[model samples]
Target chain A: MARQQRGIRTRRTILEAAGAVFDEHGYAATTIAMVLERAEVTKGALYFHFPSKESLARAVLAERPPLETVPVRPCKLQEMVDVTFVLACRLLDDPLLKGGVRLAVDQCAPQSVDHAGLFRRWADHLTWLLRQAREQGELLPSVDPRETVEMLVGSLAGIQLMSRALTERADLAHRVAVMWSHVLPSIAVPGLLPRIDAASDRGSRVTEDLG
Target chain B: MARQQRGIRTRRTILEAAGAVFDEHGYAATTIAMVLERAEVTKGALYFHFPSKESLARAVLAERPPLETVPVRPCKLQEMVDVTFVLACRLLDDPLLKGGVRLAVDQCAPQSVDHAGLFRRWADHLTWLLRQAREQGELLPSVDPRETVEMLVGSLAGIQLMSRALTERADLAHRVAVMWSHVLPSIAVPGLLPRIDAASDRGSRVTEDLG
Candidate 1:
């Protein structure tokens, strides 16, 4: 069991190092040697966990930092907002999430990995939360959960991309808050609108609470 | 004059070929040789026009499709929607615009070129129209023109990107329409809301009228 734990730690170290390199240099420019150097691990040790750069990228892409860090609230709409806020916060500070998003959006990423899958999974998660919101009468009767999920996912992607390009993502949480402020009024029922918080600092607060 | 015109035509041809290649293969995978082959121009001719692949990518990035295809309407809000609709339509069919977007989003594009400039330009244009909308009392007094422009550009980019990744851009116009439907209700005053037409076919109509 101790040996297994050590292996797990070593694998995680390599993944984090690889993600950092990929985030800074992008997929095309990244090399396994860079990962090994960053990880400060022997080539054989790195190869044991990730055989190739593609696999390392795939591993990085697969690593989704937990969104459940935020405690669940009675209002699913607020919970959904919390998820995005927390994600924005993590994306700003976490190399793994940053690298994953960069790789997922990168057109030069390995062809075998389905970058769209990440977006689809996010949509699915949001769809489930939205359905919960609908059942609780938090959402407007006119709202279609699927379409809203797509818009949320897509718009968030765009907001993050723009923030990254323009501000190096320093203002991602603010941009996301602004996005939700515009979108939520159209989707949420009037009764629930006032109750949900879409503040820019919501992400940092959640992270603070988690810490 | 004739010699200058031929030079202009040759440069245009090289740019088109380069744009198509960039759109299909992305920045890292593309090569001058592939562009030469696609354009069926001699290496010397291609080199004379665009000295390097970076220059070719830059030339492609510099090409902006005219968004003035839609006639300016009495309602600046409607005109803004028309701009997006027309762009959505153009992005669906125009390789140059598509490639430009791809390259601009591409992190690997030459660092010297400003990728955010495109978004900034769009925001600037939208800000001007939004200012007009504000002056004409088309927008709610609470609406911030700059924030609105950033959201519009970012969300449209997200919508288009989602459409491209998921549906290969088949539903971009519809997605744009949906985005506007959600966004316009929040920014436009109650009186002006009914005047704005956010329809999937609005793009094609604008294109036909322009033609």
Candidate 2:
């Protein structure tokens, strides 16, 4: 039992170090030597733990605990969108996720092995959340929950990347949420959209310059 | 005059070669030596043309010709959307823009230069188109043209990245146009929406899977 716990700790340390190095230097520029230096682990120990550099990166990319395990409230679709945006902000706000987000964006090449799986998983998570909203009758029946999820997730990630590059603002998560709410009504079932119409109207004037 | 034209030709060759190298190897991985090799120019010619590696990269990144220099007609809001999407497809489809688009997405820590200028120009172009649409009473008076433009450009770019990463289909341009037509109505002036309502309704079911 003790041996297993030690192995887990060592693996976590290497993954964290890899995320930082990859974020700073990009995937191609990052080297195994840098990983060893950052983790402060000996060469033998690093290899014993992660067989290769790619393996180490895959671990870093997949390190987050499953979203299913994350505590979620049974909020309606609009509230869920609001909450999900908040959580996305909270995740990016974390120093750990910042490096990973940077690394993911940096390595998102067509040829890179990382792009397909990471984006698909992200889409899947969004779809799952939207599916829940649909079952609760929050999303419009005319809207396909899966497709809506894709657009929402894809737009949010793109905006996040652009905002981070442009502003270096840590408050990007909040900004993303604000932008998202405006388009949210269009996807909600017609009757439900009016429920939040008052709140949306108040802030509609504030984001006139976002482009 | 002949010598100046020759110099211009050489510069074009180098710039095109640099874009190709950056596309294949990404920004960090690409080097001037590779650009020189691809352009088949001597080191002296390369240096004389571009003072440094970063300078060459800046040239490659700078000044994409405007996709739409003039409207074909008066540019109705729906036609503007269609024309602009067609232009986007052509740019993204081109070998030159393909790599640039990848760079735009994967580039994490931009050089502390005026890189935001690129996106700013894109936003400007989109905003101009939307303003024309609004003047024609196609878009809602309540719509903030700037934010709407950002969402449109950002969403299209995001969708392209996702499509490139997942499907490898060269037809993403066509796909996005179909998708955007659905999104257009949601932001159009309330009564103007029904103008395209019939067309959008037909598409709603067609694009259900991937919209």
Candidate 3:
């Protein structure tokens, strides 16, 4: 049991080091040796987990922000906001997901990397949440869940990209907070606006609640 | 004078070829040899023009969509929509600007690429147009030009990225047309919405009119 647990921890450490290196040097420039140096693991151990740099990058790309950690909400609108907040907060420090997002948008990635899968899966998740919001009478009448998904997904992506370029995503949570202020007025029920918590710090609060 | 014109044309051809190569292979993977193969130019000539791959990429990043081709409009709101359509239309075929957009979003680029400059310049342009719209009484009383610029710039970028990932940007003009439909309602004066020329093909029409 201890051996298995140690193996799991080693795997996570390698992934973390890969994310940090990818974030700093990009997927093409990052080397296995760099990851090994940061991770302080033997190359044989590294190869035991990931066979190639491409596989390592693909694995990092798959490490999406932890969306499932949030407790389910009755108000689905609040649930959606919490999802955004939590992801933004996580992005501030979690090199894995942050680097994943960078790699997803990176046009330099090899043809084999499944960049579109991330965006599509995110759309699927957001689509489900928005649908629930609409069913509960929380969404505006003109709101099409698909259209909302496109706008929300695209805008959030752009906002984060811009934030990263401008501030190294230092103010991502705040920019996302600003995005919600613009978007909610157009989509959410006016009466419920006051109750929704789209605050920049909602992510930390939710994490604290979970912790 | 004829020799000067020919030199200018060769420079343009070289830039075009570089953009196409960069679009396909990305900055890190692209080689001057591949550009020479695509450009059918002598190595001496290519070297005389762009000294390095980094310089070539930077030049492409600087080759923004030709916003000046658009005629100034009486309604800055129409101008803004036209700008979006023109860019969307051009993105369908212009390898240079499309490649520039790709490079700008690519996180794998080396540190000297200056990706943020493109976004910042675009914002400056949009801010000027939106300020004009507000001055001409075409903007909503509640709309802040800076806020609108941030939303428009980021959302347009995101929409284009998503459209590219999904359809190779075949539907970008149409998607941008849809974007204006969503955004204009929240910012434009209600009376001016009817007059805005935000159709999907407005880009082609405006281009043909100029031609």
Candidate that would win on lDDT:
1
Q: Which scores greater on DockQ, model 1 or model 2?
A: 1
lDDT of residue A10 for candidate 1: 93
Taking the tens digit of each residue's C-alpha lDDT, what string does model 1 give over B1-211? 9999988988888888888888877888899999999988899999998888888887887776566557988889989989998888888778788888888777777677666677777889899999999999988877899998898888887878779877889999888888887888889999878878888899889889888
Could you tell me every candidate's TM-score relative to the true structure?
Answer: 0.97, 0.82, 0.94
Query: How do the residues A1-211 of candidate 3 rate in per-residue lDDT, one tens digit apiece?
Result: 9999999999999999998888777777889999999999999999999999888888898875587788899999898889888888888888898778777776666768787777777888888999989999999898889877887887788888888888888888887887776678778888998899998888889989989
* Candidate with better TM-score, 2 vs 3: 3
Error of 3 at A149 (Å): 0.7
DockQ order, best first, reads: 1, 3, 2
On the 0 to 100 scale, the lDDT of residue B93 in model 1 is 71
Off by over 4 Å in 1: none
TM-score of the second chain of model 3 compared to its true counterpart: 0.94
lDDT of 2 by residue, B12-126 (tens): 8888787777766777777788998999998998999898866766676564834454234453565556444544544544545555565565563247424455566677877
Give the worst 10-residue stretch by lDDT in candidate 2 chain A: A202-211
Query: Alpha-carbon error at A29 in model 3, in Å?
Result: 1.4
Q: What is the interface RMSD of each candidate, in Å?
A: 1.2, 2.8, 1.8
Q: Across the candidates, what are chain A's individual TM-scores?
A: 0.96, 0.78, 0.94
Model 1 vs. true fold: TM: 0.97
Clashing pairs in 1: none
